[model samples]
Structure formats: C-alpha cells, structure tokens
Target: MNRLTIAAIAVAVLLVTAASSLFTVQQTQQVLITQFGQPIRVIREPGLHAKIPFIQSVIALDRRLLDFEASGEEVILGDQRRLIVDSFTRYRITDPLLYFQTAGVAENGIRGRLASIVSSALRRVLGNEALLNVLSVDRLRIMNEIRDQVNREAKRFGVDVEDVRIRRADLPEENTQAVLSRMQSERERVAREARAEGAEQGARIRAAADRDRTVLLAEATSNADILRGQGEQEAIAISAAAFEKDPDFFRFWRSMQAYREAFSEGGDSRLLLSPDSEFFRYFRELPTVTP
Candidate 1:
C-alpha cells in the first residue's frame, strides 16, 4: 500500500477509536462501566463521559422514577377473606454499583428481584389487615407500610422504592357471587322483619279501633234504649193522668186510634167478631165528647 492509503486507513482507525471512547450520559440516565464483562464504576452525573474503546463497555440505566406493575396475587386477609390484589410500584435506581453486582446492568435485570420483594411485602402487610381496613381510609397507611417494607428489601438490589399502591382489589370470582348472595339474603331478612313488625302494628291498631267502635256503638244503643224506656214511662204516666181527668173520653180516644189502625191502607187482616164483643163496644155505643 502507498503511504497516502496507509495514512487514510490509520485516520479511519483513530476516528473509530475516538467515537467508541466517547459516550453521552443523558439527564435521565445513569451509566455503569464494565471492564471485560466486570462492572468497574457507575456514572450518575449527566455529561460527556469516556471509557476504553473495546475492553470496557458502558451500560446505560434510567435514573428517573420507573414504574413496575405487579401481576394480581391472591391474599387471605385477617378476616379470612380471600382477595385478588393487583399492585404497582414506583422506584429509582439509587445504587447502580450494587445494582450491577446483584441485578446486573440491564434495567430489566432488576425486575424479577424487585417483583419478588414487592410481592413479599404485600403478603406480609396485607395478611394482617382486615378487608374493611383494606377498603377504607386506612388503605393509605397500609400502602405506606408496604412501600417501606419493599424499600428495605429492595435496597440490596440497589433500588429505592418510592411508592407502592394497590391498583385494584377484589374477591375471587368464586367468592364474588357468594358474597353478593349473602348480602342480598341479609337485606331480604331485614325487609321481612320490618314488614312483619309493620303488619303487627297495623293489626294492633285495627284491633284497638274495632274495639272502640263496638264499645261506642253499644254505649249509644244502650243510651237510646234507656231514653226510649223513660219516654214510654212518661207517656204511660201522662196517659194515666189523662184517664183520671176523663175516663170515658180516654177510652173513646183509644177506640178511635184502634179503629183507624185496623182500617189503615196496606193492612192484611180479617177479623170475625160478635157485635157484643168488648172491642166493638165503642162501635155499638158512641162515647160522649167533653168540651
């Protein structure tokens, strides 16, 4: 090869070496430098960085907050109720060197270990909590406890757990229908009891009203009978007084009333009597009228 051609090849080699030796660390990334497949150091500052071209390689990891969604896990609560829990975690790589040693350099390398730690924390914390507590305002405190426990375990994996939260929690499919049925039955029992009590009250009220109406009617009828007896007695006394005043006139007036009643319209009566009968004495001899 000529000198110009050799020099051109050399320049190309130098350019390639220069390009391989340089790397840019972004604001959102942290890089781990490895020599011959062994981690040497971690670079967290954002700027231009350099390393040996071929022997040393760089692994870039995200330093910003990352999200991990955990698969749904079934847990038994303190109340012995089974729940399927779906959770998510927010984390950051706080120690890249430790992460490289334990979890390797890839960001995905830590997922398995972190997931296990999160799951363990969830089981431990939720196992002691009742379903009511899990579903109530105390859920925030429960999540904090889970985050703290996960963080403690995650530190060994070079991850700092920022938050842990349950995205959803529900009874298992088999238990869901059972729980609903129980609730419906309970409500129905309450309604039945209420209806029975209302019926009893209504019956009692009706009984009381019926008793009062019967008593009132009986009392009114008794009072009317008493008044009618007194009126009859007064009429008898007045008639006796009128008889004492004029005995013949009273007898004649009584006979005239009897004759009118016997001959009244719509009467169905046939009387066969002798002319000398006492009933016909007024007909035979008319009583004298007194002025």
Candidate 2:
C-alpha cells in the first residue's frame, strides 16, 4: 500500500479506540470497572470517565433509591389470628463494591434476596404483635421495628433499607366468615339484653302507676264518705230544730215527704199497711191550713 493509504487506516484505528475508551456516567448511575470478568473498582461520581479500550469493561448500576414489592405472606399474630400481609420496601445501594460482589452487576439480582430478608423481618416482628396492634396507630411502631431488622440484615448485601411498609393486611377468607358470625351473635346478645331491660322498666313504671291510681281512688272515696256523714249530721240538727218549733207541722211535713217517696214515679214499691196506719194519717185527714 502507499503511505497515504496506510496513514488513513491508522487514523481510523485511533478514532475507533478513542470511542471505545470514553464513557459518560450519568447522575443517577454508578460505574463498576471489571477486568477479564473480575471486579477492579467502583466509580460513583457522575460525568465523563475513561477505561482501557478492549481490556476492561464498565457495568453501570443505579445509585438512586430502589423499590421492591413482596407478595402476600401468611403470618400468625400473638392472638393466634392468621393474616395475609402485603408489604413493600425502599432500599439504596450504599456500597456498590459489596453489592457487585454479592448481588452481581444486575439490579434484579438483589430482588429475591431482599424480599426474603424483608419477609423474615416481618414475621419476627409481627409474630409478637396482636391483630389490633397491626391495624391500629401502633402499626407505625411495628413497621419501624421491621425496617430496622431488615436494614440490619440487608447491610451484608450492600443494601441500606430505608423503610418497610405493609400495603395491606386482611384476615384469611376462612377467618372472615367466622369473625362476622361471631360479631353478629355478639350484637344479637346485646340487643336481647337491652330489650329485657326495657321490658322490666316498662313493667316497673306500670306497676307504680297502678298503685298510685288505687291509692288516689281510695282517698277520694274516704273523703266523699266523710263529707256525706257531716252533711247528714247537719240535716239531722236542722230537722230537730224544726220539730221543736212546731211538732204538728213538722210531723205533717215528714209524713208528706214519706208519701211522695213511697209513690214516686218509676218506683215499684208496694205497701201492705192497714188504711188507718199512722203512715197514712196525713192522707186520711188534711192538716189545718196555715194563714
């Protein structure tokens, strides 16, 4: 070949080599340099970086926080209740070198291991808690405990667990029906008790009212008898006074009142006395007319 053709070929080789040697590290990524399938160093700073053309290779790992979700797991609480718990975790690759050694270069490699760690922590912490604690405000404390435990185990894999949360927690299908039945029975029992108490109160009130009515009627009858006795005594006194003033006239008046009563309309009275009886003295002879 001529010198010009050889020089052109050499320039092309240099350009290809320059392109292979340079790489850009983004703000969200970290680079791991490996030589012949073995790790050498990790680069965390962002911006332009260089490596040997064909001898070394760069594996980029995400430096930002990562999220992982675990499937529903059955856990037994301290109250002996079975619950299906769905949980999620937030983590970060704090030590890239250890992460590369343990989890490999792919981000997906750590998912299985992290999920196992999180589930274990969830069981350990939740096993000591009651169902009420899991569903109440105390759940915050339980989650913190789980996060701390998971974080401790995750550190070995170069992962720092920031938070662990239970997305949902529910009783098993079999337990749900049983719980509902129990609740219904309990409510029925309370209703029955309330009805019994109400009935008892109603009976008591009725009894009190009946007793007061009887007492009031008895008092009224006694008062009426006393007034009648007093009036009869006054009438007797007045009649005695009239008799003293004029015996003949008073006798005639009394006899006339007797006759009217004995022969009053709608009366079925019959007299068996003789015609000359003293009760008929006024009928046989009229009294002298007073002026």
Candidate 3:
C-alpha cells in the first residue's frame, strides 16, 4: 500500500478509538452509563469496560466508606439543659443510580443533607434525656438513634449509614464553671458538718472520761480513809496488848503523862488544878514507906 493511503487509514482508526470504544472501572468504584444525559446502565464490577464511547459517557462513583465529623452544636436535653454535642458518622453509597438521582455528584452530594439530618436526629434523641445523660451514659443510645434515623432517610439517596458516634458532648464552659462552684459549695458544707460532728463526739468523750476520773478519785479517797481508820484501830489494839503485859508500868506512864499535861502551861495559856490533885503524885516527891 502507498504511504498516503496507509496514513489515512491510521487517522480513521485513531478517531474511532477516541470516540467509540473503551472504559475502565476500578475495584473500589462503580459507574453509570449515560446516553444523551440519561442513565442507561449501572456498572459495579471492576476492570476495563467497552461502551458506545460518543453515545454513552461513563460516570464513576466511589464504593468505599466515607465519613463526616459533625461540629460542636448546641442542643437542649430532656431536662431543658443546654449542651454542645459533636459527633461523626460512617457511610457508603449502595446504589449508584439512586444515589445520583437523589444526592447528585458523589461524596459532595450527600454531605450537606446528612449534616442537617444528623443534627435533627441529635435533637430528637437527646431531647429525651437530661444534660448529664447527654454527656454520659445515654450517649451511645443517642448515636444508635442517629444511625437508625439517618439510614431511614438515606434510602431514597441510596446511602447506607454504618455507624453514628459521639466525639465530644459537654456542657458549655460557663455552665461547667457553675456546676463546679455548686459542687464546691456542697463539699464545704459537708466538711463543716463533719467537723461539727467530730467536735460534739469529742465533747461527749471528754465528759464521759471526766465522770470516770471523778468516780475513780472518790473511790480511792474513800478506800484510803477506811485503811487509815483500820490502821488507827490496829495501833490501839497493839498498845492494849502491851498494857495487859504490865499494868503497873502502864499506870506509872499514864500518871506522868497527866502531870506533864496539867502543869506545863505557857504564860499566855492557863490551867486550873487542886494541890491534892491525883496528877501531883507523879510530879511531887513520892510518899515515904514508913515501917
């Protein structure tokens, strides 16, 4: 064949290749075949695909999961308390045709609408719980409710919501301060009460100890008195035993004691006595023993 004729055939082949032939679908992608802007087929399987290139355009869609992290939002709880709720969700596009029909485009299509829906769901679920519950244990239930509600609305958009979860849900900073102050006040009150109770207990213990001490001291004093009296009685009994052994000596000792007591008086201190007093016998000269 001539060179000109060969070059003409190559040009025609190139034009047909560009306008009427091949397509590619990846493992993580799906595609829609549109003819004159109208969807004709949905292609999910991956690899090179053939199409009427000029008559049909292939639009690719991702089949993998996507995520959206909701920003902090103010929500009212069941107890009429306000809180900031931040959350996130995982989702996937299940039906390309339906997704395109409802959401349009791809990842960009459903995000805005999903945000609105999830926000609304947050209000609906959290509204049944107190602010503390929203910040605490009931959070999981709220997430579950959001997922269910989101999935329900997503049917028309061919989007499947896999999960919804709380990232951060908390009271506002001002409200948190208020709560802390109230807690501190309550703690201080409790501390004061505890101290007062301790003081009262101390007083009771001290009173009981004093009463015991007083009783012990009184018992000791009474016992000492009894012992002293017994000691005096014992001394008198010992003296009586000595006197029984020698009556004359005891009488002589008694007469001497009486004479000394009667005669030995100070000038300022006086005593009255008879000259023939029995006490004089010991003091005066002894009588003669005449035969």
Residue-level lDDT tens digits of model 3 in 125-234:
88888876665676677678889998898777888999999888778898999989999999999999999999999999999999999999999999999999999999
The TM-scores of all predictions, comma-separated, are 0.66, 0.66, 0.63
Q: Model 1: residues >4 Å from true position, as ranges? A: 190-291
Q: lDDT for model 3, on a 0 to 1 scale?
A: 0.86
lDDT of 1 by residue, 129-202 (tens): 99999999999999999999999999988889999999999999999999999999999999999999999999
Candidate 3 lDDT trough over 10 residues, lowest sum: 262-271
Please list the C-alpha lDDT of all candidates, in the order they appear.
Answer: 0.93, 0.93, 0.86
Q: Sort by TM-score, best first: what order? A: 2, 1, 3
- Superior candidate under lDDT, 1 versus 3: 1
Each prediction's total of clashing residue pairs, residues at least 3 apart in sequence or on different chains, is 0, 0, 0
Residue 74, model 1, lDDT? 96
Q: Model 2, range 130-236, lDDT digits (tens) per residue?
A: 99999999999999999999999999999899999999999999999999999999999999999999999999999999999999999999999999999999999
